[model samples]
Target: MAEVDLSVQRYSAEVIAHRHAHHQLVLPVEGALSLSVGGRELRAAGLSGVLVPGEARHAFAAPDPNRFLVIDVPLAAAESLGAAPWIERAAGGPIALDGAAALLVRAAAVELDAGGSAALRRQWAGLLVLTLAERAARAPGREPAKLGRALRYIEEHAHEPLTVAEVAARAELSPGHLHHLFRAVLGTTVQERVAELRLARATELLSRTDLGIAEIALRCGYADQSCLTRSLRRRHGVTPAALRRAARAARPAGPGRGGG
Candidate 1:
């Protein structure tokens, strides 16, 4: 059986710098913890954690009560981590655990506490390794880094009059290259994505706010009410007014709806 160690730990103070002979994964469940790796500090909060490769010098500190799950995998089993072992550790960086990784880590933690069989531990450990390998392959510093930048730009600037050329310049790629990456990685063209984002925003306004269609159109990057109506009809098979009416009808009759 391979060497794999899993434990749930709580810390209130600082842990002296240390090096592990085996790779370690730390998953934060409650509170927050600070990890120091490669002369940098990483804040693991919410559902975020850190993966420190075997033989790497690292330390952890918890100003407040902190709880986390730590798993150790032998150097041989950690071959899947590839050449780069230490992930980026900026305080607010995107180095946190992905959804699949978080789920696997939590499941492994549960199995460890249940005193499961050795075979079960091996299986969970193997899965965890594979998931981490996938994350490492798509790490932000890799080939798709610019694509990630473009995605962030879209999410942040979708409400503006954004064009493919403008977004490509922001992402440091030519317009054609940006379009290619969008289609290849996201399976959608740049304009399609922007329009979809705008429509999504419009739907949110229609459902949550009483904003008029003309104002919502301006806010969602459409030229006017007609533009918004045309796009909504194309994408949702209904005009904005009709969609808003449907949304209003679907909402349950609240207590305020009672006749006095």
Candidate 2:
């Protein structure tokens, strides 16, 4: 099995041209950095990032204070990430991490700093890679207009009680057609996608807020606290209370800043 090396680093005023043996994903957390790669100049700031293939020639510069989360994925693991694992340009592109990805990054960071068993760290890294791979594979830069609209609708409205028919209507497509569209584009069903969005919302609430379980459940489109508990355990092998505990424990003391 391949491995992932994860770290957060800050740099300033560096002019270096180098190639790595492992594929690299550089996510800018704070400030900005410019990379000249493959005869193209890419600048990443905030949640933007760039993926560099192994052995690619690249030079980078961060003129001011910049923080970035870097992940190096082994060749075998990169190959398993679908099509092309290396993304030439990710600045303001669909390959960029959204809010959901940001949440995962924070969770992964906590896991890395937990000083737990190696297996736990590896699991977190693996999951992080899997999510990036999935997002990359979607290639949202090339998404069809209809599918894009549908996805946006789900993201914005997952908190409400929703159904495939309602979502399909909002997307201006029939329920059956929307199902096909989701399966063809996202490799999942409409219902599954909605469930993912809802669960993601629930996870965010659980980890970041002090809301009660029942209120969180209602806000996440679940009927009640029991429903949320069952769903969380079924999918994450943890109850809402347990997840909250882990999340609160993982939180850093005082304000902190880092790249995604």
Candidate 3:
């Protein structure tokens, strides 16, 4: 798969159409921006912007000098993201990114400009997508019951032993039924979702604690360190040791801390 390109660009007061054959996410950091897609105009404030799919016939207008984090992802890559459409729908209107999204985008732009390795860039992109998905889920209507149940179960059991059958039981459905619901509603299987949750928890542990890899793996419900390393490398393109080192370097200067 082609890697997603992330960069920052300054835009003046002009109408512009990007002809790149990739999905673009324009997140304004300073001034407001107006976007027109299929003759539908959507205005976003400083903290929000628009998502334009490749060949989607879109144009942007900024009233003043503005800075935006331009995320260029292949169309296939965007579609592979099961939550991308939800983000597109949310982008139809101004997206008010709270502190977390703002922080993540800022970090992403910094990482991009610093000429960090591709692995670093991809990690930040994943964080950006996750933050966007969180915002989309909070948009308006209630989430589907099964989806909500699944998410809740994952959250509660992320650091414990978990299985699709156990989660299905929590949702009051058979495992097969849960699998179908997850595929239809979330565009992924229950096992995939559980793996994602477990990985996310592992990421937090790697970043926030000095726990040994084996301990972290066991805490995150992995059978052993090798299993955690394999899954983490596949998902983040880096080994657990590298992740720990990166986190330690990125962490603020402080004295040694004890406990998780």
Q: TM-scores of the models, in the given order?
A: 0.49, 0.52, 0.48
The TM-score, computed over Cα atoms with residue i paired to residue i, of candidate 3 is 0.48
Cα lDDT tens digits, model 1, 63-108, are 5544566667776555444423433321123233434455666777
Candidate 2 TM-score, true structure as reference: 0.52
User: Order of candidates by lDDT, top first?
Assistant: 2, 3, 1
Candidate 3 lDDT over residue span 102-132, tens digit each: 6677777777668878677666665676667
Task: Compare the candidates by TM-score and give the number of the best one.
Answer: 2
Where in model 2 is the C-alpha error above 4 Å?
1-143
Evaluated at residue 72, the lDDT of candidate 1 is 70
What are the runs in model 3 whose C-alpha is more than 4 Å off? 91-93, 138-260
lDDT of each: 0.64, 0.66, 0.65
Give me candidate 1's TM-score against the actual structure. Answer: 0.49
Q: What is the lDDT of residue 213 in candidate 1?
A: 90
